[model samples]
Target: MIVVGAGPVGLTAALLLARRGHDVQVLERRTLPSELPRAVHLDAEAQRVLVDAGVDFAALSSPGAGLRLLDADHRVLAEFPREPGAAGMFHQPDLEEQLRAALARAGGQLTTGVGVVAVRPVRGGAQVVTDRSGDPVLAADLVLGCDGAGSTVARAVRPRYRELARPDRWYVVDLLAPAPLPVWPGVHQVCDPVRAATFMPVVGLRYRAEFRVTDQPLDLPAELARFGAQDCTVVREAEYEYGARVARRWRTGRVLLCGDAAHLTPPFIGQGLGLGLRDAHQLAWRVDAVLAGAHDALLDGFGRERAAHARALVRLAAFTGWLMTAGGVRAARVRSGLARLLPSTLLAAGTPPLRPGPWVRRPRVGRGHGVGRLVPDVRVRGRRLDDLLGPGWALLVCSTEVPDLPELPGGARARVLHRGALPDLGPALRDRWVLVRPDRVVAAVGPRAQR
Candidate 1:
């Protein structure tokens, strides 16, 4: 297997593939991880994936509290408190460095300074074409494109890049805190129509502020002063145009697209990187299943499920962008009122329920709606639910006896975790169990478990 563009997503895919006993090679253009700070957030789902991949977040970042909406004057309009989980605010370099190390430890080969021009499907598998002339074309059983927006591999597939929102520009600046500055300990969306912006305390000594700005250059000092960040020293600043977009297709033949190669989203809600990590997780496991002698239809199911998820998230980001920067002061006041009315679940960061496909069970089955969604990372006997399942498909029964294995994948009658240690698999439900996929997604609800 070959993974291109060894960013976090690519590294994660390679790591997972190698852990599945496959020969994996990761190719990257840069010899080392970039120090420039870009994405600075991740949710529990991403953290769960990283933990499965053997990346430690304790030394990289820490989770924080609160997601607040503020006026231009920095007055709190509405607030939603957040809880600490496996995820946290982290710098890009720290994450990539750890992922790279984990990939290496997983026995995946990483070849840096190599550029792939394109990938094509051959007779039995895929071939990777490189920029270097006279080099042999590399053949692989499978190829994954983790390349970014201008993905050459994705271009090879000739899929339409559907633009979901009008292109917009933003000036993002990362500042160094001279000391442990007494700043607000959470993310703040400055929902001012005239000057919409976001401010957050990044991990380490870093602070970042992004303003929805014109395409032209701006006086950095003045902008910092306006944002009341003049005291901090600038570490990095750049102008980037961002918007909501997703690929019309994710897979073509043996070459598949993941991460930014499949979708693009504005930074409004900080889901950009988390989406990619989730894509990598989904892609890795399904490919593993196919290679393990399962039917090839599992691969298509992976693409379908992921593309739907990516589209839903991009739409959410677009809607969130509207909520943060649309309308006048009167409209802002209305938003504040509406925010207060909003449920915490709506504001929390999590994946939407998947449609019925492959392992995803139909919804409205009794009272259990967990199918097609990630199983909660509940601790059973001091071990995470993920730790109990390990890296393969399993039957997670909350009952005394494990059920029959009709829903289990081919020859993969793996572990069974029962309620003896679970303590709580929903006290209200009777005769409940869940078939968990390798990605920890609830694949099916047990018989008679649904209402």
Candidate 2:
């Protein structure tokens, strides 16, 4: 399989596929990690996806302060604290490095400094035409478009982008702070009529600031002066247009899009990279299954599932942008008041559970409530379920009676759970057997297998 763009999403998808014994090839146009400012807030869900992809995220990250809403004068409107063991600040470039290392360890090949000319379906599979000399035209059963917003694979399928909201432009500033500023550690969303800005603190004394563009030729030092962070070395400065958009279709034929190729969420919700990581998580499993002789429609189901999930978050981000950038003093006050009323859970990184479909079995009234949701961090004999889930379907038999051998998909071994074991699962698995897909999502919940 060929994966385009060696960014975190591409590398991650490549790694996951490689771990499942697939020969994955990654293509990247840039020789170096991107200098463009990227996502800093990685929720716990995204972190779990990375860990499953073989990345040690904790060592590479620092604890992050939670989200805060502030008025034009910088007075606190509300604070949504990070949940226990929730993610914090992280550097995108560092994550790329880790992904590259993990990909190499998993035997995935990454070719940098190569430009992809085009991606198209040719016969039974897809092909990636690149500018590389040794292997310019590579064809595989699958093609993944992870190249950012301007994806060639996406262009081959659906060229039009569905704009979810009015695009907003901002002057982005990245700096290396001389010292840690604990006083302003959390992400501060400044809702000002004059300037709708975002102030952020990163790990290792790095800082980022964004000011909504009002006029041309912005003064960097002057902008930083207002934030009391002018005495710092500037890293990169650029004008970035943030948008809420998703591809018309994530898949068309053998080629599939992941990450920014599939959708682009406004940074208001800090889900830009997190959403992409989720793509890597769900896509790898389906791709592996398809390669193992699963139906072509499986990939289609993946496209439908991810598109719906991504669109929901994109809408939320667009609404957040409107709430934080409403004009006028009276509008700002109204925004602050709304922020005060906003439930902390609304802004949390956790997402809505997957809707029922091919990948997620629709739950019955109450017995299969855990279906379509990611299994909790339940442990068996002190071993994490994460470690137990292999490259295939796993069964967590919660019902009584431990069958010597249970008939399941792939003839999987069923591990029966007794009361007091895996307390994290609690009553979710009280009287039903939970079938977990390779992605760690609960696929189905029903009675224990008798055979």
Best by TM-score: 1
For model 2 the TM-score comes to 0.92
lDDT tens readout by residue for model 1, 266-333: 88667898899898888778788677777666677777887788888888888877876888778876
Per-candidate TM-score against the hidden true structure: 0.94, 0.92
lDDT of each: 0.79, 0.79
lDDT score at residue 231, model 1, on the 0-100 scale: 90
The clash number for model 2 is: 1
The true-versus-predicted C-alpha distance at residue 170 of model 1, in Å, is 0.5
**List of clashing residue pairs for candidate 2:** 64-88
Off by over 4 Å in 2: 35-37, 133-135, 216-219, 367-369, 378-383, 400-420, 426-431, 447-451
